[model samples]
Target chain A: MTGNFFYFLTFLTLFAAIGVVVSKNPVYSVLFMILTFFALTGHYILLNAQFLAAVNFIVYMGAIMVLFLFVIMFLNMREDTEQHKPVLSKIAAAIAGGILFVVMIAALKDVNTQMTTTAVFDSQIGMVENLGKVLFRDYLLPFELASVLFLAAMAGAVMLGKREPGEQNRF
Target chain B: MSSASNAYFTNVFIMNDIPEVIRTIPLNYYLYFSTALFCIGIIGVLTRRNAIIIFMCIELMLNSVNLLLTAFSSYRSDPNGQIFVFFIMAVAAAEVAVGLAIIVMIYRNVRSTDINILNKLKW
Candidate 1:
């Protein structure tokens, strides 16, 4: 049953991810991306990383995707104004991605080692209690730095979004 | 042999105590799945001209990495991988915030989100 659930979520994730790329309309793309994120959240839960699942739900699906939708709607890019990349380049891009995938598979296929279950598996390792202990202990410095990064990012976004006073006439 | 050992472990331990997903699905499957997802993101990035779509593809690639990290973290019973995944999410958020702001500013200048139009340094 769990395997079935994993397969289903995997299918949903891959399908929606492809849809996000294949859809021409920006709105449809954003919607498909949201779907993909949801499937990913489900996968996280299946993996027992419940906290990450919630964070992925809140951050990606809640915040980032909405921002994408807002930007798309704000731009009024409903029409297919994008000139498709040349057919040759499109094919070349597909081939390049395919080659990369094939190479990675070839290189990694022989390195298949199963996870050893002997090392006292802590089922609660993914829970917030254990994760928070690790985060606040070893990762404290980076955690604080991440906050500083967010502050800088927020400032930069505001600064960039701010219009120059006399530049309105140029547009 | 590994399956027989796993069965012994399950019999000795409570059924629910075992990591069912990890036991059932090989780690290689997660690796392969994430790799495919990453490649799809690459294809999208290479093929798409719209800046926002490309940005979305980049997010897709980040997600694939996050999935792989989570799988490894779970399978190994290590919390560090998930913590790294958390930080990656934070960084990605910041990146999107700044990147979209820049894209919006470019659109204001060029009045289009198409990447081809913005090629020239000085408009």
Candidate 2:
């Protein structure tokens, strides 16, 4: 039953990911990327990481994808505005990626059969209460630093997006 | 291909004393799936000309990593992996904000989003 769900979600996720790549229109790509995020959220839920699932839904599908769509729309990109790379290069890229996948699979195929021995599974481990407790305890420093990173990013974005002095036209 | 993955799947899934949820799907399956997704992202990055699409593909790659981390977290019953995922998400958001701003700035200057045109730095 769960295996079926995994297969279905994996199919949805990979299909949407490919759609994001192959779609000529950036708008379509953004939409497809949203679909991919949705499937990933489903995967998170299936893994019982409900907190991360919610975060993935809110942040990736909600915030980040919307930003991508806004930029694409703001720029007013059309399907034909961007041209594809030459066939030779596209094929080369595909070949390279395929080789990478093959290499990774071959290397990690064994990867310690001892991992199957398994640890004690705590269903509550993924709950927000536990995750937050851990976040504030063991990972407190990184949590605080993440806020600092957000602040810097916000400031930098504003400065970068701001029009320069005496500029003729604005974005 | 099916036979190989099936063999690997049985190898990983059969011997585990993991809880029902974690045992339902093999850990090796997650590894293979995420690896495929990551490779797809790489292909998108290498093939696409639009800077924004390339940026999106980069996000895809980041997401694949996040998925793998979450799977490991669950299989090991560890919250620390999920905590790392939170940090990754935070950093990813910041990255997108700053990266999109940079792309916008570049677009403003060049009047185009094609990465090929911004090759003035190439020597």
Candidate 3:
């Protein structure tokens, strides 16, 4: 039953991810991406990483994707009129992408050693308590650094979004 | 030959008794699946011209990494990877905040979200 569940969740994730790539309309793509994230959250739950699953839903599905939708709606451009990349560029991108995929697969062909073994944790381990303990102990510096980086990004976004007084007439 | 066959049977029996399917599959399968998803995301980001779709692809890639990290954490019997996944989530949130704000500002100027037109910085 669990195997079937994993297969189902994986199918949804892969399907939505493909939709994200193939959808021409930005709104549709964002919606599909949200579905993909939700399916991934399901996978995280199945993996017993309950906290990660919740965070995945809250952060990606709730906040980030809504921001994306707002930007799309605010632009309010005609989807049919949106300019696409040149045909040559598109072909080049495809070739480059294909080559990269081939190289990556070939690189992983020989290294077959297993990096980890199955060791299920206690239920409490994936809860907030264990996560907080480790975050505050072993990962303290990195966690703090992430917060500082977020602050910097916020300041940068404000600076970038701010318009000059005289620049309004140029547009 | 007979002794080796007996050992293989024992290993198979041990695997069959794992109560949870998550405990049975090799960790490499999860890692490889996530890697493929990440690769797909990368391809999407490179091939798509729409700014919003590009952002979505970036998000996809990040989620792939999160999946791999969580799987590794579970396999190793450690919660550190899960904690790291939390930090990654926070960073992704910040990224979306700043990325969309800039996209909105760009749209205000050009009236379009197509990335090919935003070549003002080209010298």
Candidate 4:
């Protein structure tokens, strides 16, 4: 029952991911990305990383996606605004991505057999208490550094997003 | 094709040992799925000319990496991998904020979101 749901979720996730890539309208792309993130959250829960699942939903879908949509609306990019890439680059990009995928798959094909299936785990690693313990005790420095990074990002965003003196809204 | 994936599908089901059930689904499945998604993101990045969509593709790539980390975290029973995932998420959030800000600033200056328009910096 769970396996079936996993496959189903995978299908939806992959499909929505493609939608995000293919949709011409920026708004649709943003909406499709929300769907993709939602599916990813489900995958996180399946992996038993429940805390990350909620964080994924709140951060990616709630905060990041909303910012994307706001930018799209603020910029006022109309429908049919997508530009046509040169024909050669379009074909080349597809070929390059396909080749990379094939090569990596061939290299990693033995991974499943190579992974030792011997050890069993608690499967509760996703619980917040365990995550907090590991993060605070061992990874505390990076955790704090991430906060500094967030501050820098916030400052940079405010600075860049600010309007110059005498600049119009352009809306 | 689809048959290959379907062949690996199992009937096992459990809510308690969800990890075991998920584990039994084979490590290759997660690895391949993430790889495929990552490649799709690459294609979008390479092919699309829209700045926001390209940014979205970068997010896709970040997500694919996150999925891979979580998969390995579970397969190895290492909370460290998940910890790394949090760092990646934090970095990704920071990246999007600054990246989209740049994209918006570019759009404001040029009145267009096409990546090609930023070629004024060409030497």
Candidate 5:
């Protein structure tokens, strides 16, 4: 049952991910990405990482994707008129993607046999209490650093979004 | 072939009698699937021409990594992976903010989001 569930979720996740890449409309791409995130969240839940699944929804679907949709709506991008790139580029991309997939599969071939029997960890470990302990102990510095980066990114976004002084005509 | 069947039957017995193994299988499978998804995302970013699409592809890639991290944390009897995932989430949020701001600026200046058209930096 678990194997079948995972197989279904994996297929959905892959399909949505591919849709994000192939969709012509930016809005559709973002929407498909949201679908991908939803499937990923299901995978997380199946993994017994319930907290991560909730965070995945809150962060990706609730925050980032909504922002993407707003941006797409705000921009109102017209359809592309330029001829699609040559067929060679598309073929090359397919080949490159195929090669990458093959390489990753080859790298994991050794581990496949060893991993046939799944190893179970304590469920309590994935709960909020345990997560908090590690976050405050070992990973605190990087956590703080990430916050500082966010602050800087916020300031940079504001600066970038605002029009420069003396750049526009005054009424 | 008998050995394989024995292992399968043994696993079935263990899974039925011991639920822990059943739970673990899903996590392992998710980790493997997420890794594959991440590879696809990398390929998309490397090959795509539309700047907006490229940015979306990067998001796809980031999410894939996040999935793997989440799975590993659950598998290792440690929540550190989850915490790390939180940090990654924060970073992804900030990245989108800055990335979209830049994209907006580019659109204003070039009136197009085609990456190939932005050749001013080309020597």
Candidate 6:
């Protein structure tokens, strides 16, 4: 039953992902991406990462996607304005993606599916309590650094988004 | 092996109580799933001219990697990878903030979201 559920979730995720890329309207694309994120959250749940699942929901679907939609609506571009990349470049992109996939598979071919003998695999690693301990104890520095990155990004975004009367043509 | 012993062996000893399905799924499956998703994002990024859609593709790519990392971390019994995944999410959030701000600024100035319109940096 769980295996069947896993396959079902995978199918949903892939379908939504393709919709995100293939949709003609930007609005539809954003909606599809939201669906993909939701499916990914379900995948996280299946992996027993409950904390990450919630984070995926809030940060991804709630904040980032809402921001994307705001920008899309704010831009208010026409629905018919579909810019097509040249046919040659489109083919090149697909080829490049396929080649990359093939290369990665080949490179990882030798590594097989023997269960890791490292510490026993714990589903509880996804629990907030366990993860909080590791995050604070072992990864304290990187965790703090992430906050600094957020500060810098926030400041930069504010600076960039600021409007000035005489700075019409300034980049 | 008796069914009871098999369950005990998988749960308490080998898996440390993770779901049986997750334990049974091959690592190769995770790799394939994530790589295919990542490649799709790559193609989207390459083909899409709209900056917002391009950024969405980037987020898609980031997510594929996130999924891969978490899958590996779970099966490898390494919690550090999950921590990294958290950080990646933070960085992604920051990226979306700054990226959208830039996009908004560009749209304000050029009145178009099309990349071709912004050929000159001096404008």
**Model 6: lDDT of residue B35:** 85
Q: What's the TM-score of chain B for every model shown?
A: 0.85, 0.83, 0.81, 0.82, 0.75, 0.83
User: lDDT (CA) for every model shown?
Assistant: 0.89, 0.88, 0.75, 0.84, 0.74, 0.83
Interface RMSD of each: 2.3, 3.6, 3.9, 3.9, 4.2, 2.7
The TM-score obtained by chain A of candidate 1 when compared with the true chain A: 0.94
Listed per model, the TM-scores of chain A against the true chain A are 0.94, 0.95, 0.83, 0.91, 0.87, 0.89
Best by lDDT: 1
Q: Each model's TM-score?
A: 0.93, 0.92, 0.84, 0.90, 0.85, 0.90
Provide the fnat value for model 4, as a fraction from 0 to 1: 0.66
Per-residue lDDT of model 3, residues B9-116, tens digit only? 232323433225345455556766776788778878778878888888888888888898887676555787788788888988888888888887887777777787
Model 5, B18-107: lDDT tens per residue? Answer: 224334363435556766787778767766677777888888888888877876665445577788788888888999999999988887
lDDT of 6 by residue, A1-55 (tens): 7677878888898899888888879999999999999989988888888788989
DockQ-based CAPRI category assigned to the predicted complex of candidate 1: medium
After superposing candidate 5 on the true structure, give the runs of residues whose Cα lies further than 4 Å from its correct spot.
A81-83, A112-120, A169-171, B1-28
Candidate 1 C-alpha lDDT tens digits along B1-123? 247225433323434565678767777788889998999999999999999999999999999999999998887778999999999999999999999999999999888888888778856
Output the lDDT of residue B109, model 5: 69
The 10 consecutive residues of candidate 6 chain A with the worst lDDT sum are A112-121
- Candidate 2 chain B, which ten residues in sequence have the lowest lDDT sum? B1-10
Off by over 4 Å in 6: A167-171, B1-16, B119-123
Tell me the docking grade of candidate 2. medium
For model 2 the local lDDT of residue B65 reads 98
Model 4 misplacement above 4 A: A112-120, B1-20, B121-123
Comparison by DockQ, 3 against 6, better one: 6
Candidate 2 residue lDDT tens string, B1-123: 233323323434334434454655667888999999999999999999999999999999999999999988887777999999999999999999999999999999888999999887988
The candidate with the higher DockQ, 5 or 6, is: 6
Sort all candidates by DockQ, best to worst. 1, 6, 2, 4, 5, 3
Candidate 4: pairs in clash:
none
Each candidate: RMSD: 2.8, 3.7, 4.4, 4.1, 4.1, 3.8
